[model samples]
Target chain A: MAKRVGMEVSIAVAEAVKLADADVIAAYPITPQTHIVEHLSELVADGELDAAYIPVESEHSAMSSCIGSSAAGARTFTATSSQGLALMNEMIYIAPVLRTPIVLAIANRALSAPINIWNDHSDIMSVRDTGWLSIFAENGQEALDLTLASFRIAEDPAVCLPISMNIDGFTLSHFIEPILMPEKAEVDKFLPPYKPQLWLDIKNPISIGLLGGPECYTEARKATDDALWGAKRVVIKAFDEFNQVFGRQYHVVETYRHEDAETIIVSMGSISETAMTAIDEMRDQGQKIGLVRLRLWRPFPEEEFLAAVSKAKNLAVIDRHMVMGCSSGPVGLEVKSLVYNSGLRPGISNFLLGLGGRDVTRDDFKYIHEKATSGQVQARCEIVGVFE
Target chain B: MTKPTVDAMAKVGDLPMGFTAKPGSTVAFKTGDWRSVRPVLDREKCIYCGFCYFYCPDGVYQDMGKDEKYYKADLDFCKGCGICAHECPKKAITMTLEEV
Candidate 1:
């Protein structure tokens, strides 16, 4: 049985992990991500969830503990944001290479110089190349659903890699929303107990994460890359199965009325919802615009993304993280390179906005549309709404 | 049991997932070639106290039993760190430069 209930998004994500029957949770409390681990610790303490809640001293130990537990054939999980994620960077890169199928929840936040704790994509963008299967959720429901799906996708024998489910901090993570909470039986039907292909067994021993001399280093890296690219198939299959079981459909690249539009606004995370509202308003006024929401960031849904924007003559690629000194933001760079390689010449305008908890209103989306369509958008990334 | 070796010619697809290898696979990778010096045992002064066997970092020194006069170094895996010579109470073992 699945029932819609009002719940905090972070708590809902924690509940989703419980539903997946995680064996261990090793996490340090950081703002935005703290509530999720807090709830998980409560669940473990109350005996509602039968899992080890390791209160690690730092985020680095949290991820390292997860790798050890996951390697020992446990379904492991953890959550972090911003500086916490940065601290886990070293272990984060090692997990996938060691084939540890740990599920990580990231509350996307702004990294610090002034030390601000707010919602942004800067945190996630920093570790974009860590070889983890990364996905974004635009709302509480998606965040919950993706958390469950990540465990399934990561533990699959064909895709034994770590996964990070990113939810915009404060905006999406701290918000209370009505989410369809799936029962344990339903979740069990969707995601069975994790069966690892390789694990630390005393009787039948195997060594993992060994030193790769130059002789085999390239081959090892190539093998991991192939596994990551191959994970897209498992992701699709898991989502399809989820649809069948839970009656909620999800796509790697979801679109909002972009089939016949002349211009498309590309965005990710919670800001896409704002873009959708703006698109609806523009449509009412008879402007030919739509939105393409990127749900899967890594193993970048190449063919699907190109197909989604193929008919559009103009594209407003909204990026929340500023890749300093680069010509464009991270998402913008990805889109430009993708389109260029695909031989498509769409006028793609990269807009950087809503950084460090700055509000991104519907008008901002409308402004981006105007800039993109007016053919005055520059080759350089535009920082929107900076105080003069 | 013999350790498994990764084929040098194996393709990317043929390699093991996660770069995992059989346990104790270092047995196949002989590190003795890395050594610039070798340990020489003087059976005459050796009291066979087993200090060399315990001190050798690579487990290179093997007990030759009471019937034999001294312990022996398994040169096939020894890296010639000279820990055995340093730890020998009888001073019966010495490190000698390997002939280039």
Candidate 2:
């Protein structure tokens, strides 16, 4: 039985992990991500969740231990934020190469120079090429649902790769929302116990993460990339199965009012909700604008994305991380490259906003629409609402 | 038990998932070719102290028991690191460069 209840998003995420019946949780305390692991620790302490909660000294060790546990055929999980994620950088890259399907919850935060702890995409963007299946959650409900689905998606024999579910720090992570938490039995029906295809077994020994010399290195990397590309099918299947069991539909790319629009805004994470409200207001006034929210970040839902924006003449891409020195932000670069390669010549304008915890209002979305439609937006990435 | 051999020239699809290999697969690769210098032992001067046997990094030197006067290097697995010769107390082993 699934019942709607008001709960913090972090706790909901923890509860979802528990329902997945994770065998091991290795994590270090970091802001925003701290609550998720802390609640997990409590769950383990109270005997609500039967899992090993390893309180690691650092994020690096956290991910390393996760790899070790997951290699030993345990359903392993961990959570981290800005600096924590950066610290786990080394192990993060190796996890995917080793085919350790560890589910990681990222409380998306801005990377630091001045050391600010706020919501942004900087943390996730830094490790974008780490070969992990990356997904974004626009709300608390999506966070919970996606976290649970991540286990099924990652541990699938065809897609034995790590996954990172990114939720905006403080915004979606700290917010208490009415999420329909599914019962354990329902979750069990949705996601069965994890059965690894390959593991570090003592009886039947096998070597993983071995040295890939020049003779086989390229093929090894190609195989990993192929596995990631092949994961899209499994992702869709899992989402479809999840919808069947939970009655909540999810897509790699979700659209809002884009059926008959000339201007479309592209965004990810929690800010898409704000953009949606702005789109509705503009629609009421007959502005012919809409939004395309990317729920799946990695292996970049190509066909779905192009279909979502094919009819649109103008695209306002909202990027939360600034790719310094580059012509555009990370997401912006990806979208532009995708559009260019696909031969779609939509006037894509990259807008950088909500960096290091800056507030992104509906008004900002409207302003972006104005710039995009009026053709006043430049070809380069523009930082919106910077105090001049 | 026989170890499975991975074909180095195998295509991306044919390769094992995650570059995994069976245990002791290194036996298929004779690393002795990588050695620039090979150890020559003086069997008559050898005291059978087992110094070369204990110090060989690759476990290249094998003790032939009480019958043999010195530990013999298994060139099939040896990289000719010279560690066995360097650690020999009786100076029974000497490293010599392989002639081209």
Candidate 3:
């Protein structure tokens, strides 16, 4: 497939919405995510997408509308950033439990106290356990590609959880780039109309979201948990199906020349882009360095992450945010947990970097790469070069 | 005064799975111990920020109608968590749990 030139991240987002053939879009504008929804709303206004562009009063209503639309068996989407995501916090817990395959684009942004509008993991990390299958995108192309991928994974009968597709706030979402938009016909062939085994059927008129007692509550949770566990394979299937259609490959945990490299710096979201740039620059200088990027966050691809790092003698897991009162950084904790379970244990440890929208300069990568190679692994997570 | 029979019992929602807030099960509750003397938000002092509503898991606070200027806390459901009292920014809903 030839690359399409100059489509902004927001427009790439719009293109994905068109490809997914979403039935409804209910979203409120909030910075970075605003552009994505603005483009999507324009697509709706221009008669490009046959969908409802709901100008909702608040992010809560935006998610509520998505829940309502998805329940009616309509393929639904919404995008939000920063405080908008905070506002949607209530419904964040509800959409997945309802098993509505609602895909949302979360342009990752910092939540407020001092009220800054900058790129940070604070917003998405807050909803980490909201039961949505989460994926982070590295660039504009991946953003578009994964938005389409999200639908296939989300609507999979075995994986009926809502999917939140994350693009870094102001990093990828605002950055202009050239990318490929797959032919709508080909995309349609890949993703069929979402047929949820559970939906609101007017003619049949079945009950949805019934209040369960102690007896059924556990079953409801088990159903969603089982579906998530089931999603592990369904995600691979969806990726395999996509790869067959296009020559592109999708890995839950993507490796960029990570094989056999003794030391690698690992992170997610836009930090992966910086990490790769570091890899390219260092590799050109004859340094045997590599990188691993976690594209999928939820359904935490533990087995795949282990395989990616198996050959490495040294590995540094970089987290973009803090877990607050703990010995763990959020991503660092997950990586450590996976290592603890894997048992095959290469020389793996954790590092905290690029928190609260602090820029991870190319020089910063050089520092982290050095930390990866400096012999002794921290018995636990280390704050990599972050000034105390 | 006449008491309603079991056959004539009025119910609200459908029975979910098992017992609910039933009349005489051993599920202990300290409804009496849960009482507090928080200042009923004089609606006049209410800005309707809705913080009280969000903080209340018991659905204790709700607006009665469209014209309702401020939400009133439902004393029936209020478990006296005092979360609302502590979180109230305007110091409007005060706690008098202790007597002056």
Candidate 4:
């Protein structure tokens, strides 16, 4: 029988990584994300999980070591939060450039200026162009499920790029939630033993990370881009297969009561859950408002997002962090870019809210819907809940 | 017999997967044409200490048996980096301009 337990999401992520049977884990301790690596270390020490738990000195070293281990034909994993992810930025770029299939669990935290340890999308947004497959988890169960799915997707021969699974720090990471943990046998059936197509073996030598001249640089970059796009298929397939085994379905862009709704609120991470409640509350009052949550952030899920929101007259995007100086947040910017190109002119209103762990209540969602529908939102985006 | 520069296993053209074969697979793509300065090893002054063999980044020096007497640089893979010539203990190696 599968085990169901109430545990912290970080601990659950650690359990999920262990369940994936990762060969190596390299990570450093960072707030909200510390429990993940801590638990993973315990599993390694207790001999419950047979893997190398590399307690690297820094996040940079953590990622570098993960790259080395993954390149050496090992299924590797690592976890980090805001500043930790920022430190690992260079290696994050290299991981995809080398096509190393290392799974990174990011407990998304706010970036430092005042050095706050709160949940936000700033960390992951900072490395958006790093060419890794990115996914967001709405709750503990999705975090656990997606962590397992990351390994399956990243290591696929067709999609040998690194993947980052984002779990909102403090909010999702610290909460003790009841989750159905998959049996090792079932996980084993869902995910096969990883056999790397390309590896650094001494016996059969192969040159990797060769210097590409002006002639080959474009092709090299093109190859990485194409690999990420192709990985979308493998990602969708992995989620589908996971659903088949676990009986919980997931999609790139998951909608909640979106049909027949004239207006929809768009968001990602745990905030989507709040939006769901708000949407349901509004729906009961005979408001045609629904929620559209983006689960897959990277590869952008353009087609699905467009299809999901095409019928809606208004799109209110709730971004946890803003792009600063830009009219909207990164999600809003990308959504606009996608919508603009498709020639679907919806009155898109972007709301920057819940930054630095601020509470975004159900009332806030209702207010956003009102502002968006009444055309009171400024030019493109508005900083909601800020006292002027 | 002169072997072809690119072997069957060496990946040529655009690598869509970024998958490369074995370490030093660039041996198949000879860098001899990249030479501006070529190292000339004098057998008379050479002590066969294998410093050139040890120092050359490109694995240009080919060791013929264990003897110090028959060490020769394979021009096919040598990019004329001259680290071998600079590291020669006995001053027996000279970096000569290539006849390009």
Candidate 5:
């Protein structure tokens, strides 16, 4: 119980990769994401872990190599930042269509115009429609834990989907902190070396990528579609197993004081910790407030989301990146879609805050919550944090 | 980039031609040889994106001769065989395996 040491989130993520026991680590160098692969590189080099480390030429090839390794039935891992993730965009759809449970760590960074290296949801949001399940981590501890859990959730027999776990770029990964590293024996009992039932093998000699006519295209898509929707239950089962082993409680939608509160702030990734601090401050000042931290974004927790938001009169959902024409932010777009789709009566508002690694303070939360409760949805889409 | 294995590419099977009213088809509705060429679109849940145009060989489908509501293959010229179905990215076209 006392072997705890100061570990950077990036290093913790590397340790989690060891626990996940990934068979292939395909990567290209990119900012904020470089150290994770570097640490993983040392592990593989030192013969501490048995795996193939392919130093791909580009982010596109990093994804391409992982796709091949995954198709050949290997548990694959990789890490990339803004441009690197954007470069592998097309393969994003292909990876899940093949139903490979490849786990990628996104060092959340801003998409370039001015070429910023700051933390933002821009990189992840761009690929939101690619059918990969995305999980967010609030700190280094969760950054380590969620990455391991992601492999389990993604590779579940019922789910078989690709997963992306986002850890804030300069914020969490580089920030040094104390972490309890689990023993290899415990991780071994929890996760087994991946044995794929279906794979691209020469001996089996079966065909994939066969042409399907209108007569059969629907069924292929249907299988992937149904599998994703079914993943909600799959994730819960995997999470339950994970919780029992690790002593951590995770739900589709994690609530803080939502049971008795009149107002709720919905968020994802590292901002949840800041939101909690804000909640504490607001509560001390006699505001009946709470927080809902969303962990999984794909297979968008429909019934659970309704149940969570049903009691709240006022809700403000924060999105780190805008969804362009259709909506302002990705999470904001999702929350609105769920609200409109289910016909739930919560007064949901969209808040586009903490973008490009802007440190969101307690004061920012107080202002957004107050405006949201006063029935101020200030845009054609809900763009929170604007000043006159 | 290394080329995709010619052997792997060679193994993709030819599409079936003309239909049979078999009791064992997974699809509920199948066109059985009446129209000479059967077009099967799987709507198990169709996103309805069209990819069949690029796939058809033999110039069987006239892009536009009369009406273009839906594309059709010239059956008289076609051997009643379905290569279009095999090449279709969406798998929306099916030709029943029939004797030429």
Candidate 6:
């Protein structure tokens, strides 16, 4: 059994990265995500971890340096949030195309126009098409566990792709909770030294970045798409192996009291925990309502999601970010698109809630469930807790 | 180009993802076929100044020793951009039409 210690979520993630023995950590400090990079810098400065802690000027350079370091066959890691992720948008796409297995910890935060430094899915949702393996952490233990697992998944020979472990800003990133800290020896047995399959080297010089004309551009894209889809198998295998080695198990779609529910509330991030409390209260009163949490966002887990929600007749999707001028939220849109042809007809009501970390209490979830269950919602999607 | 090198390029199917060759792989890819006009050097009026060598973006001009022939363009890799011809001070180079 691992020793349990109480620590801030961001520090736990940094400790996990330290145990993974990362060769390089290049990052820029941003609100909510600052503690992660700050602790990593201290590890390097205190000689606790032997690695290069590059304090880059901006997130763009941070991701660029991470790409260069990973291409040079180093185990590279970085952390960022909100605008920082937006700044590194160009390099984020390059990491997957170049097959550089760099690990990123994104403290999921709201994007700015009014300049809000709070938790939301807008930052993570913005990079939905960037072709990185995106996963969400519900709590501190998961934030730590997934950080270690990301390196394994990314560096896996079958799945040589970048990964993003999303920690909800201020909610999960700042929350202090008791978590099981695995020993270094236990982690060492699980994750081995990174052996790069393809790399930039001097001795065995090779030319990369060949010109992809119109004739070959589609083919290159096809290959990349195929690789990302194939990564799902490796992701499952890694989770199973992790469970076998360390006693904690995870699924693509985790359910709570959903065995024979008529209505299921779907969600992601830390709010899923709040929804669980709401579901428990609803179930005690025989309301027949349950909860479904999406653990994996990208490589979207369509089959697993369909199977998980198949038992429910109605679904109430809670989205943290609002897609302006859209029919539904991003997650709801994807879920609707996926289940359109599945032949399992179920009414999905999207409730766009918790923008910029708005207070979404148990009563709010109860309201969403009541509205979705009674089919009293006027549109397919509606904003909750807004002044409307 | 060597037979094996050309064979390898032919083996690359529709998608050439991260296709890497030797250090000087660029030498293997001939760009002369893309040229609509070729640089014709009037070596007789040539002054051995290496202006064309410095101006050619493709490194087309090759140094032949300082004895008599100072430099000449390697046409197999030249796109004939006319930079070298435009930069020649002595009017020793001219762009000639490459027939289809």
- Each model's iRMS: 1.7, 1.7, 12.1, 5.4, 13.4, 4.6
Where does candidate 2 stray beyond 4 Å? B1-7
**Candidate 3 displacement at residue A154 in angstroms:** 1.0
Per-candidate interface DockQ score = 0.65, 0.69, 0.03, 0.28, 0.03, 0.37
Residues A95-184, candidate 5: write the lDDT tens digits. Answer: 776778899999999998878898989999899878788888888878887888888887776677789999989888798988878877
What is candidate 5's DockQ? 0.03
lDDT string for model 2 (A328-380, tens) is: 99889999999999999989899999999999999999989989988675879
Over all chains combined, what TM-score does candidate 2 have?
Answer: 0.97
The reply for model 3, stretches above 4 Å from the true place, is A1-3, A284-286, A379-388, B1-100
> Which prediction has the highest TM-score against the true structure?
2
- lDDT score of residue A91 within candidate 4: 86
Off by over 4 Å in 4: B1-16, B32-100
lDDT of 3 by residue, A73-177 (tens): 899999998799889999998777678889999989887876878888878888887778999988998898889999999988778789999998888888899
Worst 10 residues of 4 chain B by lDDT: B1-10
Per-residue C-alpha lDDT of model 1 across residues A1-388, encoded as one tens digit per residue: 7898999999999999999999999999999899999999999999999999999999999999999999999999999999999999999889987889999999999999779899889989998887899999999999999999999999999999999999999998999999999999999999989998788899888887687777777777788888899999999999999999999999999999999899999999999999999999999999999999999998799999999999999999989998988999999999999999999998999999999999999999899989999977699999999988
Model 5 chain A weakest lDDT span, ten residues long: A204-213
lDDT of 1 by residue, B3-40 (tens): 24254645777777677788766566676988898999
Better of 2 and 4 by lDDT: 2
Q: How many residue pairs in model 1 have overlapping backbones?
A: 0
If you score just chain A, what TM-score does every candidate get?
0.99, 0.99, 0.94, 0.98, 0.95, 0.98
Model 4, B1-100: lDDT tens digits are: 0222134332233463554534445556666887898889888998878899999897778887765575799988788888988999899999999874
Summarize candidate 5's per-residue lDDT along B1-100 as a digit string, tens digits: 0112111112112121101112223233233334455555454523333345455554556554333334555554454457667766656677755445
- Candidate 6: pairs in clash: none
TM-scores for candidates 1 onward, in order? 0.97, 0.97, 0.77, 0.89, 0.79, 0.94
The alpha-carbon root-mean-square deviation between model 4 and the true structure, to one decimal in Å, is 3.8
